[model samples]
Target: MLQFKLVLLGDSSVGKSSIVHRFVKDSFDELRESTIGAAFLSQTIKIKAEEQEEDVVIKFEIWDTAGQERYKSLAPMYYRNANAALVVYDLTQKDSLVKARSWVEELKNKVGDEDLVIFLVGNKLDLCEGEEDLRAVDTSEAKAYAEEQNLLFTEVSAKTGQGVKEVFRSIGEKLYASKKDEILAKKNRELGNRVNNSVDINAQRPSTNDTTTCCS
Candidate 1:
């Protein structure tokens, strides 16, 4: 069992808790409270690597960080030594994208180019298709940024469990591969490089705009 801490960061209503619930409990609730500091959960995702079965017991450390601007500066503390982070955004709301971008920017600056695995999630996919399309943050824009940052990106609907499994599954694989390389190479620099290559954010989607954004 590999112990990895995965933090979730985004605006309060962006569905960070919902995604964690679906991935960890395999269930969803319409009414859920915004996380104050963080909550920890353990999930065992089976990932096969190098023809051997590996148990990826990610701590699934769902840090439903406070979205209040006052609490914003404290985000870095949660991610300080985390293995991965899930930066979520409400697909139906463009303002959430801006907040997500800022979070990504901070992570990029603090964690260095070679460390930290980021899962750029566009949440509320189920709510995206019906009401509006005038200036929705194109999923592609997030994908492009993830690609540049060498992070993973996905569209998820926490309500329906769509893309929920894939998100955890992929992150688990990357983290596992990283641990294996680091263990075998016996060098921190090499380990970071190997892990960085494991991420192909470009492998995911499609294109961008001046997405409206807000941390509150």
Candidate 2:
């Protein structure tokens, strides 16, 4: 079992909590309330591949952080020990993506040389077409920014539950593989210790199985 921490950062009404709910509970709230400080949820994802099959209990300890300025300063605390991040924005709101961009920049600057896997997700994609002002928040904008930042990008809708599951599933698989590698390394170390112990036992064994009287 792997416990992977993930933090979701985005402006209010951008569907951070919605995405979490959609993935974890498989339900959506139409009259949802804004997130308080942060919402935490955990879900395990089972993955199967061609080489081998295993149940990857990737505990997605997700933090649906608040986007309010008052809570912005505290946002870093949630991501400090996170394995991955999903930066979300509302496609119906252009300013939200701008705020999301600033958050990404902050993560980049503060994260230093450590490898941070970030996914740029735009929510409310089902509301893609509308008036000119609403249409301004193009999916390409988020996609371009993610490309520049070397982040995985996707658009989803919590209302319709479209592309919602895939986004987290992908992240879960990634974190699961990373956890599996560590597990395999630990197992190998244990095996090596056993081998060394066996070698020591053989070295200490007395060669008295058969006493042979031979001319030396």
What TM-score does structure 1 among the candidates reach? 0.76
Candidate 1 clashes between residue pairs 3 or more apart in a chain or in different chains: 95-212, 95-213, 140-207, 141-207
lDDT by residue (tens digit), candidate 1, 111-136: 86365789999988887765655437
lDDT of 1: 0.75
Per residue, candidate 2 scores C-alpha lDDT tens digits across 1-216 of: 456779999888889988899988999899998888988888877665434465545557788898778888889899887888899988878898898898888888887635567888888876774554455476676778889988889988888899988887888776656555666665466668677765544224322221223542
TM-score per candidate: 0.76, 0.81
What does the lDDT read for residue 48 in candidate 1?
A: 60
Tell me the deviation in Å of residue 10 in model 2: 0.7
